[model samples]
Target: MVTAVTDHTDHADHPGDDEGREGSGHARVEDDFVTDRKDVRKKDFDMKDFIKRDTGKKDAGKKDAGKVGVRSESRMFGLVRVEIDDYPEKPASGDDTDGTDGIGNKGRADGAAGADAADAADSGVSWDDGLIARRVSATAEGQARPVKEAVVDSRPPVVTPLAYDGSLRSRLDALRELVGLSRTRLDSRTLAEAGQVLDEATARRRLSGQHTVVAIAGATGSGKSQLFNALAGVAISETGVRRPTTAAPIACSWSDGAASLIDRLGIPGRLRRRPLQSAEAEAQLRGLVLVDLPDHDSAAVQHREQVDRILALVDAVIWVVDPEKYADAVLHERYLRPMAGHAEVTFVVLNQIDRLPGEAADQVLDDLRRLLDEDGIALGEYGEPGATVLSLSALTGDGVPELREVLGHFVAERGAAVRRISADVDAAAARLWPVYANRRQAGLTEEARDEFADRLADAVGATAAGEAAERAWRRNANRACGTPWLRLWRWYQDRREPPTGRLSVRTHADEEATARQRVEQAVRTVAEQAAGGLPTPWAQAVREAAVRGSQGLCEALDELAVRAGAPVGRPPRPGWWPVAVLAQAAMTILQAIGGLWLLGQVVGFMSPNLGVPVLLMVIGIVGGPGVDWACRLAARGPARRYGLEAERRLREAASGCGRARVLDPLASELLRYREVREQYLRVTGVGV
Candidate 1:
């Protein structure tokens, strides 16, 4: 049997209680006990093995020893006596045990202990007590147990890192610093001062973290000064009846930062750099740096130069155009198209919109936006989609606030200048890379060169010279090698030598003309090929120059011949070797003829029968071979000299052709590309 007992430890503790119980050899088990106050007579116990026999009567006299206190002692009387503190003595219930009283009691006590263990487990204190009791009971009963499995978690979590580059304002600051460095290198006073103004503008932009520098760029009578005054909230810039009012840049700032920005712009103190008067004006401006640049279409060279220089360094440009000249080709072609990459940093303002009737204003704005879009600029974010069309009379102040607000928001965005400059430089670099880079050979092939040389040789009658030289060699051989009799016979044979039946004077002239044509055609072809792919104007110029050079070369060659006193008919068909061979042939023939005549005169009167004519014949034959060898040896010097002269002429022609056709065109194209590139770099804030 088992019973549960709840022990309130503070009330239950007794001093020296364990010492008092020690002599009985009773082992104390640390355990919690629970009991019900109403169940004083009977103990409801929990046990592993026990049988309950029901009894009819309630045993009021029985008490739960666990509710009070129970003490167990092993006595020499061979019995374990259990004592109860404040126990109400009563008879045990009949269900407490079987008829064997002591065994039943012992089982009830063990069941009560088990119940206490259960109570302790329910209270979340000691599972060990219950577990050990179960083990003991199991061992006694010879039962087996099952094994348990362990648990694990398998999934893991993921992590990421965060980092970013500088913000728009900081990047603008960096650009300003770069511009400052560029400014210090300028030599011209006006340009340097302009550079200083640009620096000041950049500094303001950096400090305020705003896109602060604004420029009014436009043609004469474009109301750029008026726009500037409207933006400045004051008529600081002179407006006109004058043809071109803003001769130099006029700058205005909201704060002290404006002075630095103006100074960096490199504009002289003649231009105003006024601070805003009121807090509201200051608040409205926050970080604005307005500049009035000179007219782009002005005839004055200085005015144009000023506009160009300021445009290079300004943060954002407001291109002002009057309704009358908004679509001018000069404005679009010269300025807009060339600066296509700066579309992001540019704002096209169709000023004097007030002059247009109400209905016409909207239409004009639409047209303007369309034009700007065609030039690759996206509008809006500065105001309405076509809000770039501000119908304001700087004279009337209508819509001026709207323009100011747009400018303010643009400054707040802080991206206009940076994006503009970056894109400009990138575009310029892309365009120029191919131009500056080494060009691949596409003009002349080696086979073509050889063909040209062959043509030139033919034109110059090299083959005809070769043939004539061969003929001369034969004549020289006969003269130099023959005996006197043979010489006489050779002279007779020469007189009978066949005429050139097909090779008439006309044919020779035709050949010479064909050779000249061939050489000229070959050189012209090479020059044309080299000049291919060049721009039309440059290409035409080069071609004209090449023609002139060719004409000059012909004249030069003519002059060289005249100076040398060489006959002007054509280059000699039979060259030096041929002439030498002919001379040798004549000498050989004369000797042979003399020897034969003398031999015939002395034949009968000679004592020693010397074969003078035969000896002369042998000498003639040997002399022919020696003469032929000597002619061959002598031909080398003249051939090399002529070849060298021909080479020099060829080189000069080639170089002149290249200069006129290739180098000139290439240089012009490259220079144009570079100028455009530098302008783009300056606008976009790129390093050299």
Candidate 2:
């Protein structure tokens, strides 16, 4: 029982009608009369009619679209009830709503019509540029009562930012550090090459990255000059029958802002040129700087040298070969073979293909590929990344477009400079691999250090000094507590021998000389053990460190020996020594009295008792000996403890001196080698 209706208003009355409906694409819903739901009519306005009606009368409203204010009214009268949910446009100043509809909604026709035009003009947004509101909803009158949710359509596209790449810079920095650490330990020649790579990479990065330097090089009479002129679209480089027409390099820039890059190649300003004035046609080659190098096999030595120098500086190279000299041994062996690692930035062109008939060109190309393969250059075909090979004739202009297209793509990528520098780093690292990581690291071992300390202690005579101290202590104890007659007898017996009152710990000159020899030998032995299994250069470095540290070590050891072996005096006496001395004295007196009585009795000067004399003699004999024996037994333990303490002091002093002089320096050198090797591994990306 539902029906639909469409209303059309005259466009001539509203001068700003086009502006009101410019980017708001939905048609206006208006004029609803409430009635019973069974008899309701719902209708959707046709968009084609709305657009056609607007376009047909657009000229009448165009003049005043932004200037004049007009009214647009929509009215509906029916039994069906409809609700209009309109998002009114932002109104201009001094406009208000004046009318209300059946759904209790206020309507303002004049303000609504002029609001879009005023807001668009003020915000500088073109509604015709498709600025549509997000919410456009409507409700239809039907028994089912369908509802549409407010949603947005045709939002602007999102753009993602590119991530920065720092892998190349990081690797180059690591290589530079390794080179710095290896200056004294590694060969000068190998270090110089690594230094050159670092210098080149730094200088190339300082220039504009947008420009790529590509050189055209070949042997004499290869028509490389002709190819260069053809690619440049001008005859700037001299070409003739001369032996070496292009003695120096000539630079051709496709676009501007390449003067600094060309100067970095060492080309003079007079030899620089712009190929074409109009840049839009050669937009793909905007950053290409082409150079024509001298003949590599020229008879003139300087020309060949110039070619070699320029080739090393350029980012990429194109080797043009004629069919006659395509497989020259000098080109393959001297240049191409050595540069096999740089295949990603190389191009091989078979020039003068016009001379070869139909299938001959393809056959020669296949043969060139085979030669390059033998030279260890990968072919950039079948979707592999390698050197690009193609056939072209500079004279006939055959296959020039394909070469130009390939060159343009290569130039646009803007990665030739980075790739070439990275290849150079790889080559340098490969050359230095043997010096950095040929064998397992060897370090100073604990057993070697202990043996070194023991040797030094022996050289200083610590053991002999300890034994002398022990004997000195025991001899002093016997002298302090022995019986008076026995002491006199012992002193008289030692009159012919040297004095034993103090220990003789002083070392002789010959012994000192022998100790010096032992010190040197110990240092050498420890250094060898620490540097065992190391490379020759590192071993030499470790030995040098030990030698440098051992300069005044022998003198230092002599001084330490003197301090540790100082003369030892008598040990402190026990309190029982006095009592023992008094007992010995009393025993001597008793023995003297007994001897006198016996002499008197034997000589008949006085009457004597034999029992008393005999008993006195026996008591004196056993008591003095027993007291001396007890004191000697007590002195043994203290003497041994004192000797051990002296030994420990001397041993520790010798060990400390050896550690400071030899072992520490050797260990530092080994640590330095390990640090440099670690940086080399980082440069090569091993284990990381």
Candidate 3:
């Protein structure tokens, strides 16, 4: 339901204020009320439509929440309220104003009144008649009328949307983290790249805002100071006879904006922020923080350290390498190779070109370009073919103007140093991610494992164990349950009884030969699988590693078996049944002696009734011991001999796989990790 109420306080100013026209004026008021109510209803309808439209198109062009575009709106009011639709809402309380109210006089008035009322309520003010009378009087006098001054809230929007840059920043951040992790795990190039990343990140952060930091990097006696002087248009840095000069960093700046840039660099105000004599002396070079770093090949440890530290934090780098030392291994290995990715921000200067013969200058420049290419540096103008390599003699001021112009243009572009570092870090990280990933290995099929297991079981004398158990059970049963009348019945029962632990013995020859063959086959299959799909060099390495591992396993197993005192050779089959018959005869004679003694004892001299039973017991006990001793003696010789033979066969099998001691896989993996790490570090400008 809609309700309309007109304020009567302004009745005096109405057209029909006279008493005679009260009826018409009242009708007019009702009509105006209806029109206002219709307008409100229309606004409500529009709001609903807006909600539906927004819901329908929600996913049409959704971007990352963090990267919303920043927009600004200017309001006429002193208090400018920035409404951010995407901003998260805060809970409403008596002290805090809820911001969702529709924009109109009523909403504003109610909000303000609510706040004041809440304040009054907290102050223990009573809502009595006296207060009402005072309010009425104040209203009559226009003192209590709501103030309608337009508020201009200049606050920036809560949700400052960033431009949609295709998640480049996030990708870069991930890459940086990866590089950092690689630095911890590996060494060599990867580690160097990681250090470079850190250096760039630091430099970028340092050079952000209005600060300007310029670094001069070059080899010894390369006219760096001369170039520094040319750039500064003054003999600020020592040069000429004092070769390899500028052992320490010398910072130069113009009077204007000099203090600010120096301060940003954390250079103390005490360090002379010297002002140029001419008012327009630093006009072209305003905001330039020129730093003359030590020569790259200088022997001073501190000098090198300073060069490294400043290079990391500088806004721009001027690489001044002379034609002679440009191709030096120390320069390329120590710096160029590692900093190839920073080509965009790097300026390669071929200093002291005046020393070269006129005809040789062009050749040298070409050689420098070729060297840069070999170093993997992208050269030339933006979107052009190669890195920008300029030939200049700092001593002669030749090409200095062109170098200065390039520097000026570069500074004018004012790229984000932090962003660039972030990019480098991201790139380095992307390169190293594969190493940490869980590489999938080709797995053995279930059928293969089962086949191997079956082969192993057969080779280990499974059938022999079964036969031995059956024979042992039969022998024990026959000895325990035998009678003269039931001897044939007992034999039948023995044949029917399941074998226990007596069968044909597993001669060492059989066990060792079978085990050796099975193990060899298993090792060969494993080695083949490991070597498969690898490149030639890697395949050979894998094969060699596998062979070594297998051989070691074989030796270990053989050693363990030998220690267990297993038989090592073939068991003997006696050529004579006479030996067994002789042994039985000896047992019979011992039984007769025992029987005579027992008879003498029983018949007032020996025990007559127990003689035969005593004799049987003696024979049975003696016979079992003799057979057990004979079997052990027969098994010992063959077991020892064959065990060594099995070991030798396994070793031969391992040898067939490949060279058994070429390289340790674990150590090789670690070395590869180090190499990759060093490369990564070099790419990112991270030092070891």
Candidate 4:
């Protein structure tokens, strides 16, 4: 039996909420529940007439129960729910009482019923029929199958790994930027090594991307040339025991495409040879450029140098050793230990293991493993990726196929070139980390800058200039507003030395020398403050920048101080000064008139009574002194303001000079150091 339910929601409660009835609104609710309330149509499906029932394996005397299956489908109209329950049992006879097969038309016989069942399986409701058929089939078999439910996944997608060439190119770009930014601040030799690494990486990438260059290197009498010949399947490199047989490097190519790569290794064209043609063996080793390098411990200096040069350029290295010299100190200490980080591209081959007897070969291999572990080389055992350590006798061909199979897979991966370049970049950046990276984020503080400016101001005598300005104002005020006889007496005294001459900014030889010393000390103090907690190279750069900037600093300060403090012509007089001068003139004239009248009285040329003249003389004497004192008192406030303004201008000029000469250059050097450090971090992939 099939049951169908269609839900019809009423919209009468929310009449104004028509937003849910639009196209965009319907899309918004698609992820949610089906809430459409208009134009919904319902139809029911009779699943019994179309689905097949299995009748072979029913239990004895047990009531049959229909399988339960629920399906919900979403449409534009509304949600439709379907369920199956209480399936009818099959009849005992082959032909039904109604003369029809359960899955076809009403009156069809066996052959026609088969055709009709095929037609019904192809109908529009086939998905429903298929699901019901599986349920009934499970029921007939008397098995309880767990119902499958939909699972909602909420996890975000995984981030893709970076591509090899892209990431390497980005690191190279960052390293270039780091070198450019660290020009005058870092060690020249370290930067040169970094540049060389970048150059080598670029040149390697320009060659064949399909090929892998594997170099076989070992000490004298290690049979590396024999292993090289075994892998090449030809006697390409001569192998005899004359202490050091292979005196130079030789290249063997499995394919002809590695000419450019071999040329880059500085190998002559005559030493390059193709392996013997065995199609199956050669096809597995295609695109392989195997290099036979000279003995690393040869008595000849050029042979050792040749080994070093070729080892530096190869994409991968196979260190071949005999059973006796597998733990040689020169090989372990100079090559294996130093290239420990390049373990992924390294292979340690214990050659001539056929020479050992019984379990002695196994014991020698175990001891070699111990020595490799001591040299910090990780072994690629138990499916972990590291250096590949194996035993083989190149002369007897005992384990050469295993080495050949490993090399075949290694060459086919075509990742050795990229890995070697990445390891090289990592090693170079690690070496430069001490010069580029520091724990503290050092900078110049505002207090230090302010104190530096204050020191410069003091060195130039700004405070003394301000005091002298105030005193000059008071003296000029006295000259303009004092009584005429007092003024004449002051002018006679001032004629010996002018006040303008005293206001000139003149430094004697000793004072100038002292000012220079003070400027140097202030510059040094600020440089030290800025350089604190920085790396040695950067700290030295900061100090050098400050010293270079302070070359003519003392002279600049002297010029600015003279310009700021020099008095222009005479001091400016206020409008009130003229009024005070007139008052003083009136008082002086009164004194003169009174003295003339008293003189007339004494000479008997005028009236004898002189009371008015005596009164006039007394008023003039008291009034003149009182007016002079009043003018002097009024000049104090403006004189103070003028002095402060002079001091302010001088202070500003001195501070500005100091900032330009010392502070700005130091800040720029610090900024350069910061930029270079950031680039270094990018190259190293630190904090990525």
Candidate 5:
């Protein structure tokens, strides 16, 4: 018998479906829905097709049953769950109603069962298909939601390992600052090398923080290549008795993320390898970028050059030596002693110890340590054992684990590059200590500047200008406020010598020539004073800077002398000048009238009015003396005041020229000295 357990309940009418539809409209971003809507429609169509095919099969079974009306009491969610349920035999219409299955069980039951079997065969739907259900969701307005958001498993988050982010940022920042300062200010070639070290370190760190480069440096026949292969646990570098077996540096890294670092070291792609990942013991040595370098003592020039280049960039160095050449003078002179400050990253490997007796090997290692100590190599990390001297034989694999363990520790504990660069910066700072340290904080004192200004003032003829201005001012005053008779007398005398009682500019071609010489001497003296007690080279620099203005000093001074000392027009006439002149005019008019009357009396052209004439004469004569006295009194003070002002104006201009030409340049040198000192203190970490 065909039985269908279908969910006839419309999901659109389900409780909370209205809320779901409303929230879905708002919850899904419009852009996400727009792009994915077509796919959602396709899935919906496929699911609906499955639903229709299922319903058609059931309709055929039911058609056989309306003939046999068969039904079952079972519900499905979103899918039709089909299960055969055996129905009780239906009573014939004329016989018994013993069972109530709602369908007559006469002959239709057999017919419907047969039809259901045929439809099941045609439909080919079975429970074995992994997708046993076609899910349906209701959107707003009775529409189906085709696709549903996938549910993620709720679990604790998996923590990703953190990469190094310059944990020593401040210290490295300080060290880089020191390197930059030393490169610029320190004349010594050592600082340039230190700067190179810093640049390489920072570049490598930035490219990949996880990797620390280790260079296996050795002389001819030192077995460094063999050790490189041994440590990497694979023969990444060829070993031979031939001279300069390694022409270029060969990089063998334990980790996968050091490609950029290897590329920066100039290692070719063909020469790079991940050689130690297979070994469980060596797995802890990740981020160790080991290089087999060309022998430093190679006979080939290019080989030595390659060795020098790689050694400079690597974070740590392992010096490989044999018993036969454990104390080679060339290695000590060229590499070890000079790199003593780098002991934190330096290791002296006494290789080929298998050939020596145990005691003999120990003695050789001890002797190597003593030699390193004498070279001022402080062993260890910041006063701990800096350089590790170990005996390892690559041929026999003796003590290889110890070397590997030490390197692994180094690679694991971060900041080797920072430590190395800091040591180099320290070396650079030490070299510059004498150059910049122990300097005074004093600048050019005010007393010294004033003296320089005074010298400059004399050269520009300031004194002469002032004196001339004083006299010129007095003359101008007299012209405006003096008695008319006295003024006329002075004006007549002016033809011989122009009045000097006003502002005057006195510039001598001869004075300028002499002034130039004085300026040069003064510039030199100021430079010397500013450079006092400084190092010889810096002192010379200061002196040169101060003297640079000397080329144009004389010309500038001459220009200012003509301009500053020249009169700024005549001083405003004192308030009393107009009054005095007016009074003088009146008195002169009275005198003229009185004299004319007397003349008329003498010529007998009119009666001699004796009373009026005598009174006019007396009044005119008395007024003339009084007005003259008043004019003299008023003009004296005005002349003095105007002369002083004119002198001051001229002096001010001359002073400006002197400052620009000489004083300003000298101050620049002083500023330069102060800057160098501060930079030096910062680089050296000096408190002051």
Candidate 6:
């Protein structure tokens, strides 16, 4: 904008750049020099006229001057006009203008000065009112002015786009969630058609948010292709007396943005039409992509297949029917009746209605609607939109406008694709509900879990491990804490057979096989119990999950068995064993010395030591035996306690080993199924 300022003297530079000013939506500062210039020029041109008209009438001239001042003041100070001399009050000596007029040359200069002052005052009057002014004085000052651009300082407000409908977004979100369900549990193959529908909806919307795909479906000789051409207002599809003339799929859109959608439907480029510009009468149908599919009852298998393929992908189906074939079983029984959930996007057009009388046409429509209702179709009325029933003749273009309007309303709402996908998802989810309903609501019982753990424990020879720990503990305690006199006998027994090698017992290969079989049996039992009240398919699924979970468990159990059967570490003994051994040693030495002396005396080779020797021998022998008895008695309690503790530890360890190998996997499978079920419920909007 300021660049223009450089070209024109009046257009001066402003605060913002040209581009910024244009896009800012802001007010620009402007100079109102034109209005002031116009007022001044008018005053100067009328100066002579005013003097001639009121010659010699100085009072009249004075009145005229006063009025001019009032008018000019109004112009300067807004609507409120006031009266006063804008010129420095003309000289009291009557020399205010030149002699040729009413005052001298000095007064004329004074008038010019006063005019400049008035113009300045007028500019600020928008902020504050002017006191007084005169018009004649304004003309003396040439108002060399600039254009005043209004000053705009506020920023634009934030705006949110309303491109996609809220309901459409929510419905698509729901369908997307439904598609995320587990394949193994949901029969993905069975839902393949529904899955294709979901993908087509999202892909089509991504490419073109506007176009509503309306597929023309009917048996041969129904004039479906002609109806499609009539709706398009163009002879796009090859329509004639020939049967199944529309070989591939003939597609025509009313507006742009449907190229990718057409490609996704696998329509060949040759058969596909570039969208025609929207017309005023048919503007509402601008977003509609009408597809003329091959006849459903075509003799050629490929034609029927093409029809089926396009039918599954399109947003809506317009079933074109002749009066004679309107009640055809193949068309309604196989397709319409099975698609009850899709009533919102289904259409039944009784074509050739023009061939019938008014009463006959009405009767045919009523009968057709009745058949549709019997097929579980919810026919849309004038106000309520659902499955619609229309009667028309594509050959004569009768009822085409009404059909166009209907398509327009659907395309305008932009919900046909979403509604179509939502129904598909609902149908698929309904089919998969039974497998997950009960499991989603409740999990496997705690008793079942405990029973499973116990089964695993028994499978891995938990008893053998416990008994091994106990016997090992006892052997260790007795060896470390029993009497020194019995130590020699215990060493001899260990040397003889190694104390039965506690925990490391021999096992037959057949016993291992039997244990493994018992483990598998236990898994089966737990699975059966968990699946008790479920329906057959779900029960079978649970059983399969358990079997899959239990894989490699037998091998893992063998490893656990080897570990459980191994000997446990020895138990710690009391410190009193050492003191007892020392005391016993001393007593034995004393007894030996005393016995030697007594023998010498009895043999008559030494002094008679009867009193001391006999007493020492008796005390040493009796006390040593008594100490052994006391140590043995004390060892019994510690040994039993240590044994019991060892058994408990070993049993717990063995059970844990078996559990990780077998039970954990089984439980995880069940848990996964439950989590998926919960997710499924959430997608269904039944739970948080």
Q: What are the TM-scores, per candidate, against the unseen true structure? A: 0.38, 0.65, 0.43, 0.65, 0.57, 0.57
Per-residue alpha-carbon lDDT of candidate 1 for residues 8-106, written as tens digits (9 for 90 to 100): 221112212221222223323332222222221233332211111111111311244222233322222111112222223233234343121110111
Runs off by more than 4 Å, candidate 5: 1-202, 234-236, 273-279, 354-362, 381-385, 393-398, 424-438, 471-507, 530-548, 566-648, 661-688
Each candidate: RMSD:
32.8, 20.4, 25.7, 25.9, 24.7, 23.5
RMSD of 3: 25.7
Write down the RMSD of candidate 5 (Cα, Å). Answer: 24.7
Error of 3 at 357 (Å): 6.5
lDDT per residue as tens, model 6, 633-661:
77767666655564455456546754664
Q: TM-score of the candidate numbered 3?
A: 0.43
Give the alpha carbon lDDT tens digit for every residue of 1-688 in model 3.
1111222111111221111122111111111111222343354334235334544544541332122211222211111111112222122223322222211111222244433343233323332211110011101121222222222232322221112132444444444554554454445675576556655554444333443567778888888878886776544556756545665676666423334344444443222223222233345555566777787788888778877777766666788888788888888877876777677677889987888886788898888888888998888755673346798988888999888777666655555354345546655665555453223433234554445434433444333443443344334333322222245666688899866653434555565776778766765665565444433433455566656665655444455433432234322223333454455445556666766667676677743567465766577557645644564454444444444444444333333322233224523533444454444444444533
lDDT (Cα, tens digit) per residue for candidate 4, span 523-578: 99999999988888989989999999889988999999989883786677777999
Candidate 2, run of 10 with poorest lDDT: 128-137
Ten-residue region with minimum lDDT total, candidate 4: 131-140
Better of 5 and 6 by lDDT: 5
Segments of candidate 2 deviating more than 4 angstroms:
1-165, 179-190, 234-241, 276-281, 322-329, 353-385, 391-399, 433-438, 477-490, 499-507, 533-538, 566-568, 571-637
lDDT tens readout by residue for model 2, 89-174: 43333333354321122333555446545433433333211211211122344344333332333333232221214877777888
User: Which runs in model 3 stand beyond 4 Å of their true positions?
Assistant: 1-212, 253-288, 312-316, 323-329, 353-360, 381-386, 416-688
